[model samples]
Target chain A: MTDATLTRPAFRRGVPPQLIGLGALVAFFLTVELLIQIGVINRFIVPPPSDVIGSFGRVIVEEDVFGRFLLTLSECLIAGVLLTVVGVGGGVLMHRYRLLQQACETWVAAMASAPIVLMYPLFLVIFGRSMWTMIMMGFVAALPPVILKTLEGLSGTRKVLVNVGRSFNLTPSQQFWKILFPAALPTIFVGIRLGLIFALINIVGVEFLINFGGLGQLINELAERYDLPGTYAAICFVILVSILFFMTLEKIERWLRPFD
Target chain B: MLTPANPTTQAAADDAILVVDNIVVRFETPEGPIVAVDDVSLKVKPGEFLSVIGPSGCGKSTLFNVVGGLLSDHQGTVNVAGETISGPHQSIGMVFQEESTFPWRTVTDNVAFPLELTGMPKAQRIERARHFIALVGLDGFENRYPGELSGGMRQRVSLARTLASEPKILLMDEPFAALDEQTRLLLGDKVLQIQQALKQTTLLITHNITEAVQMSDRIVVMTYRPGKVKRIVDIDLPRPRTSEIVGSEAFGRYVAQIWADLREEASRGMRDEEKHTLEHHKGGAS
Candidate 1:
């Protein structure tokens, strides 16, 4: 079935997918580093990989990199928790109530395409220039996909499974928890992954735009000072933060739905 | 020629574990109300393997659904073990034509699910589930997910789950239709063995006349649209038989008789489908 292919990551020919992805990333960094050393690409605009690596310790000690990373991680964590709870909850409610689904499905789906980051000024006014602004921003940005995907997931559960429940005389609550929820989990995880990634991106973007918190803010300050190596170093940490978040999220997803 | 309804239907109901009486289902579409099942009735005696065979779109599934309590807007009274059922009943269990095993669950967990709902203790349910699993010849693959198994194996898992419930009457709707001919025959043999061992009353819905002949004590042939019982042919095959019986003379005669009965109805169904597409095309052209 198409679902079999969609749920499991393809690992063809005895090779793991992660190793291929890692190899590509390393090759990309090496190519850029080589181009810079050969004077094919300017070092001022984009620092060489070796220079960025060399300055990592200095950036960590002088600029408190770990603190910046922690701040971003906390913001992501808070936003992640809010989106998962509200997003999945909203999807279930909307699915249960047809009127709610009809009224909001299009609006919510359209929200996914909207430039939510542009409205950071409004968030600042409402939530103020504190961490709430970034946290709220991430939550809002991530919410749509989670809700939509959850709806998709729940609705996509095969009719046969539902009938199996009904034939066996499952109560409404038991049917939902036992059949509908687990059947919808793979698609829901797709939503969670998208929502978490969106949350992380917007949180960092708000940090950079407002110049107030996290890796985004540190990168902003470093760029302003023309500390190119340190800025690249900080940008690297942003990538690191996202990869870390995704790896952790993936582990959680596996724990929640091991079959996928 | 229309053969009368099962001559034994009235006589057998007293001893029957399951009785589907006068089931008539009408589905309303833009075209208007279309009768799916029309006054069809059946009685499955305990330990009997009965099959309802018909052409595609002949409403065998609709009748199956009505009997299983999955379809409510139907004219029918389904009684299981002397209790009339207006909805899903504890004494009735259904296996479906589609892939129904929960993908997230292991084979053992899937089989143990119904017991879990009843608040049965974990160890007991797991042990009971293991017995059914072994009966279906899936002893070592208990922990594997449905996605990891082949189509035939997954059907076996679902069968094990349903059998674990020990329902008074089991309803199976085209359970092996998706498998290859060889797998279908082998699984059919396996099911026959298990059913006889447990004396499980089973009602299978299918279009395969050979399957009906091979697996059933009696076969009910249904007409096309507005499906009704067209005929009932008794197999009279000896007990403790396998699907290998298909090679025998009696099996061939039974298959031939059912095929002859279903041929006209199948043609009628195909003609209606063709006419439907023609009307749709003409309307779109206009």
Candidate 2:
């Protein structure tokens, strides 16, 4: 404590976290750029960071990357919507029914560890290499964690809180919406973030494998033509898509549970 | 219908607002059936603060749950103002031992929850809830969440919530059990002040000797197992009391007397636990 007080007037002072983060990122890219230019690191396998940044405009204009990003974003949003709706609803159902929970909770946990992308061939046959196939793949890959975590969240509500609800004589629906749902929300958000991670990976992976969809297909073509700079640039757009969903999810969570 | 059950032999029944009549609770274990509470009965006069003090595993919580309508599988009836409770009753409110405040809700919102369930208008509920918040001395904390508040402050929020609901009887199961001694005593003083101001009938279940003696008008001591009322000790202290009374000789005497009554039961409870563990070990050996 005394050390902190003594050093209070030194160079150590408050700084915005985002600024420091941006600085670190810039320093990393500059170091890589210098390394590749100095020939200490080969530029064949990995392009210089400057070239990657320089190719961003070309890829966006020539590849119609924004339109493709929007397509991928919409498909992901649909899959995400389905994952939460179906997964949480399924969890709530299982929570309400002990028999169902006992029967299928293990199966859901098992599915979480299984490679869900293995079933893409069947999804391909059914959806015919369209957006539906990718959507279905993302939706399925992301679902298990949401269901398991929803059940976990609902089950984890304090007995005291539920008793308070009951003592007030709340109806079934009111008990759910007022007490159970709100109490379980933080955990449910955790499930959504985890599920979206799996969903986005599978969605982009399928797009790359089939060469017919969004950012992943762009990445595949750029890699095939030895356009390493453009390939990395396209991967940044994929990261952008991820950041978009995560930021929106965080905003919604903050809005819903302000204190937590 | 409940008025007919009032026996003329018991004068307190005529004025009692809450009555627990012959409640019996049993739980079936793998070994056999264990009776938690055996034909326990009590009554609380209107505007009185009554406490039930006992050792752990004495089924004090079982009786508390029965009274609060959280556990209803017991064989008996809990009546509030001549009305029988089939389940969670509107006239009955509970303050629990665990942290009961919702972390997502602000102080005013948590207090306003019961009112919101009753479909009161948003503005009216907020206004009413603020009154109770102020009553519990948490006025400026109306917008703060449970996570933002201290443990004692959060308990105050729950207390305010129960009070806002306007329940005829408040059932508290060791509400201040989690707080430090100083905070507990201070909060206990506040709770007593609020109870007197509202003329609210309260039933408190706790194992703290001084806590039971400090706030209660009367305390019922329960036995270790198959919990039965061992004695009912009336606190003859003056009214409008505060935490200051704890330093007095009379308060210490009351605490000592209740402790004497509870000491044997607490030891018996510990012995029974030891015996059970020993028996389990023997069975494992076999």
Which 10-residue window in model 1 chain B sums to the lowest lDDT?
B1-10
What would the TM-scores of all predictions be?
0.93, 0.93
| lDDT, residue B206, model 2 | 98
TM-score of chain A of each: 0.91, 0.94
| Best DockQ among the predictions, by candidate number | 2
DockQ of 1: 0.79
lDDT of 2 by residue, A1-260 (tens): 78877778533566677878898999999998999999988999889998999999999899999988998899899999999999999989999999999999999999999998988899999999899999999999999999999999999999888888888888888888989998999889899999999999999999998998999899999999999999999999989999999999999998987896
**Candidate 1 Cα misplacement greater than 4 A, ranges:** A1-23, A37-39, B1-3, B6-13, B284-286
For model 1, residues A1-260, the per-residue Cα lDDT tens digits are 68766676546545677899989988999999999999999999889998998999999999999999999999999998999899999999999999999999999999999999999999999999999999999999999999999999999989999998998888889989999998898888889889988998899999999999989999899989999999999988998888898899889888988887
Cα lDDT of all candidates, in order? 0.89, 0.90
Where does model 2 exceed 4 Å of error? A1-12, A30-41, B1-11, B275-286
Q: What does candidate 2's lDDT look like per residue over B1-286, in tens digits?
A: 0122222323355778888888999999897999999888788899989899999988999998899888889998888888888788878889999999988889999999988888899999999999999999998999998999999999999999999899999889999999999999999999989999999899999999888888998888889998988877878888899989999999999998888888999999999999999999999999
In every candidate, what fraction of the native interface contacts is reproduced? 0.97, 0.97
List the DockQ of the predictions in order.
Answer: 0.79, 0.82
lDDT digits (tens) for residues B1-286 of candidate 1 = 2246763653354688888888899999899989999988888888888899999998999988888887889887888878888888778778999989998899999999989988999999999999999999999999999999999999999999998888988889999999999899999899899988999888999988877777888788999998989887777889888877989987777777788888999999999999999999999999
